[model samples]
Target: MTGKFIVIEGLEGAGKTTAINTVARILNQHNIDDLQFTREPGGTPIAEALRHIIKNGLDNEPLTDKAELLMLYAARIQLIDNVIKPALKAGKWVIGDRHDLSTQAYQGGGRQLDKTFMVTLKEQVLGNFKPDLTLYLDIDPEIGLMRARTRGELDRIEQQSLPFFERVRQCYLEIAKQDRTIITIDAGKSIDDVTKQIEQILTKWLTKQV
Candidate 1:
């Protein structure tokens, strides 16, 4: 049987790294050990290069919002073609740091890009491709940014204003409400509590797949 693609998404400091680990551990507990991990705008040589530029702008060059959005999709397509699709075909479950939902939130909502354009671009690039499951760890932007500040310097995207991240979070919630596959959890809780939530959600979802 083909494997599933599960994505973890949220604002910076939303504990995505820990959540990914929890998902992996739970999958292992279920005897699903063939796991392939990946991150957005990455997972391939080409995508990594794009990731670098996206994370840290090329020198002092101004990265336009439209360009940034396009680059993200470009990196995503490369990763999907070279890594994710192949892993799924091989029956190895693909665990991702972020996915298309990120663009819908970050670029579409945060950047305030035209909805028509965003929809058109998404269709043109990804078609019907999407994660089988998405776990969005939600937290207030103020608290999340404070946590992010402790992690050293912020990246280009991470350096956006608080209002920008607020928009991103709003978009995340709006979409999560509309999509059954996307699960939203309050990440402000303790790690153990968050892990319990993830385990419960994943275990129930996994049972249905079987």
Candidate 2:
């Protein structure tokens, strides 16, 4: 059986991890085998090390916009080649916490990176492995930051200023507008409500697409 690749996208603290976990439970309930869940920039060993450099600090005091964008693509290529594509090929339902949208939002949106550069990199690096379904969790940046703050220590990216998050959210909206494969979900709702909505959406998609 062919597999469905479902990717969950959102700004920082948009409850994406919760949604991913919920989707995993839903798929497991249906006896779906080989269900694979992963996050960008960290799916494989080498990519994970890169993620650490991006998320934490490895050597540089400040990372340039171009470097940030390039690193994201590098991690993406590694993830797609090593983990995501293979899982789909083996008939596994793949649920990803985040994917290319993060690059568009973080690099293109947040950092004001070059749009043409991103497009070119995506074409050259990603080729044809786009997600079958991309779920975008929408939430206000302020609310998201508060939620993240309540969790624990903030990472480098998470500690970014409000303006940065605003840019990221706007980019996400633009992405949703441009990509028909993406579905937007309000992330401000209670956990149960958000899960219910996701379940309904996934159930509907599975019923029709599968």
Candidate 3:
């Protein structure tokens, strides 16, 4: 049997890494031991190199919007084909830190790109591929940015304007509304509270799956 794919998505400093750990623990409690964890634009060696380029801007030339989009897709397809798909086929659950929705929110909404073109690109690259469940941790952009700043200097994409992130947040919410498989969580809450909510949600879903 093919295993499930669970994706955790949010803006920078949305506590996605911690949330992933929480999800893994929940899955373990349910005896789903075989698992794989991945992050995009990374997982495979080539994808990691792409991730470095995407996050760290060039000194002289800025990365073009279209180029960034293509790079993200390139990394995504590489991880999916080389790692995620094979693991699922072997009945290992895959948990991802981010996925295609990041592109939809950042490139489509943040960058204000052409939506139709984005859809065409997605279909061409991914076809019907999608996560079985997506937990979208929603937080105010200001709060998220503040948290991110404390860690270190912002990355290329992270240095975008406040308005950009507002659009990204709006896009995320809109997409979550349209997709029944996606669950929205208020990440503004305390970490303990967020983890509790995640556990509750996953427990209910897992029960149904059984």
Give a tens-digit lDDT track for model 3, residues 1-210. Answer: 259999999998899999999999999999999999999999999999999999996675788999999999999999999999999999999999999999999999999889999999999999999999999999999999999999999988999999999999999999999999999999999999999999999999998887
Please give, for residues 1-210, the per-residue lDDT of candidate 1 as tens digits: 469999999999999999999999999999999999999989899899999999999989999999999999999999999999999999999999999999999998899999999999999999999999999999999999999999999999999999999999999999999999999999999999999999999999999998
The stretch of ten residues in a row with the least summed lDDT in candidate 3 is: 54-63
What lDDT, from 0 to 1, does candidate 3 have? 0.95
Model 3: residues with Cα > 4 Å off, grouped in runs: none
The per-prediction CA RMSD against the true structure, in angstroms, equals 0.7, 1.2, 0.9
TM-score, cand. 3: 0.98
User: Candidate 2 on 1-210: residue-level lDDT in tens?
Assistant: 488889999977899989998888877777776788888878988889889988986666787778777888888888888888888888888998899988889888998977898898989988776999999999999999999998999988998899999999999998899988999999989998999999999878777775
Off-target runs (Cα >4 Å) in candidate 2 are: none
lDDT ranking of the models: 3, 1, 2
Using alpha carbons, what is the TM-score of model 1?
0.98
Clashing pairs in 2: none
Error of 3 at 18 (Å): 1.1
Compared with the true structure, model 2 gives a TM-score of 0.96
